[model samples]
Target: MGKASTVTSWLCCPCRCLFCGVLSCFLSVLACVLLTAGLVVLVLYLLFRPHIIHATAVSADLTNFTLTPRTWILRYNLSLALQLRNPNKRIAIHYHDVAAEAYYEGQRFAHADLPDFFQDTGESSPLNTAFLGHGSLVGGVAAAGFRREAAEGARFSIDVKLGAHMKLKLWVFRVPGPKPKIDCPLRLKRRNATAGAAGPPPEFRPTECRVWF
Candidate 1:
């Protein structure tokens, strides 16, 4: 019985050691794989740190504008010129579902839809959208403000907001990325009817606009 007990102990010890050895090998391989993945991510981030995508409102034209004093009805037609630029040397940007809105003193008066397009690395694309606001009623305060600006020869301000979904294309791999939100505050100089001269189109200074993800 003693000899049988000793033989059983020796057999169990070898089996336990073999099991432990296999588990250790698997754990080591998993750690190595995790480390490799982390390093790859770090490298990618470093390589793409300097490149940025930007959107700007380059110019705008207020073709027609009219206001009825009796009914406080406003009508206007405007066109906006937009530019999208990708400054990355190796990364391209794909933009989708672009939309824009124009607001006058927190009141939305116009909306525009832009086409989906892609911009290559170090390239820019131009976009033009026309906005029409026909027979829109305005509040008394808004009408008063417009009149005051016109009388004083002050610029009228309009806020334009843009939103779009974007993706990054690096060679054959297309990675999902963050969307962009852009705000362009435009100032329009009222046309001078007394001078019998048509004013120039509204100008947008890119440096004054804000762009973010």
Candidate 2:
């Protein structure tokens, strides 16, 4: 009877050890699963998240358009006032650089900045120099690509002040939360604009302006 009892105790010890090992492994797996699930939930929330409606392109107008000779040899200064209407509840619109492009006779002639009346919040960043034209004064005719003399019968093409390849980036954030990036493209046209003598605006209009959701 003594030998039988010792054998029974040994068997029970091994069984308990095996059960403990299995329990530890199960708990570890459970923790890993919970961590993975949390990550997945966070990703899904970010992907489908809706952002605050800030500034939008309500209407764009160009006024006080003027051109004058620049001190630089053959260059001319092109200055124009840009007025943007934002129906969204935001106070100001942020542009990387907003400016106007002047196309004459189907060819790009000069680029100018949107009026500096629009203020930028960040000082470290360059003032939203919308066009190739620098702030304060923008040299027009003498720009690198165009000649000093205006084309005899050039038609004007007006586009938004951003650079040719540059686009607008809308930042979405609930302060203290991770900020997400949304890219919005602009659609600008010369409105109520008249052409020189007998010219119709060129056919190179943007197909559609992109808006973020």
Candidate 3:
């Protein structure tokens, strides 16, 4: 009876040890899983964070610019087309408006409240005229005196200010954060006017547009 009791005691200790080992292993696995899950949540939050910003500019050819038949009205008005491009892996969600300045013959004319829209998500968009040059005089001839014939062989300079809001998705791996205001300057020569020419300006070819993120 004593021998039997000793054997039973030895067997019970081994069984308890095995049970404790299993419990310990299970607890370790649970801890690891919990840590992994926390890391995943953190990664997802970072990947999905919003409010990214960006800016860029694309200028159209000045020579291909158009003027109305009423050359008198054109002296004060100059229209230019521009393209906005997003080089990031994200979509350009919004624009903060645009500002442009034109310089001709040493006179500086500023234009604000330019129109804006989204372009191809990964490509370029149709040329858009966001600014129109105007003179102080109300459609007065020579107020700005910028007829197409007079503009021939003339040189001009442009300064552009652009603002944009961009975003990234979880699928995109690498993306840049908010960007600084984009500034661009360009020089161009006016085109010669042609008789009997109709339709949009030669440089006014429309471009396909889209946006994806």
State residue 34's C-alpha deviation in candidate 3, in Å.
26
Candidate 3 per-residue C-alpha lDDT over 1-213 given as tens digits, one digit per residue, 9 for 90 to 100: 999999999989989999999999999999999999999978866754433232323335453333345443233334455454544444433343444455443444445564545443454443344444544323544334445334554544444444444333334443443433544554444544552234333343333222222
Candidate 2: how many backbone clashes? 6
Ranking of all candidate structures by their TM-score, best first = 1, 3, 2
Question: 150, model 1: CA deviation in Å?
Answer: 2.0
lDDT of 1 by residue, 1-213 (tens): 999999999989999999999999999999999999999989987887645567677777666556778887777777778787778888888989999888776778888889999988899888677888775546777887777766765467778888889888888899887878888888766454553336555454653457887
Cα RMSD for predicted model 3 = 15.8
Ranking by lDDT: 1, 3, 2
lDDT of 3: 0.47
Each candidate structure's TM-score, on Cα atoms with residue i matched to residue i, is 0.71, 0.28, 0.39
Residue-level lDDT of model 2, residues 76-142, one tens digit each, is 2232322223332222234433444554324344555444333222212222223333222334433
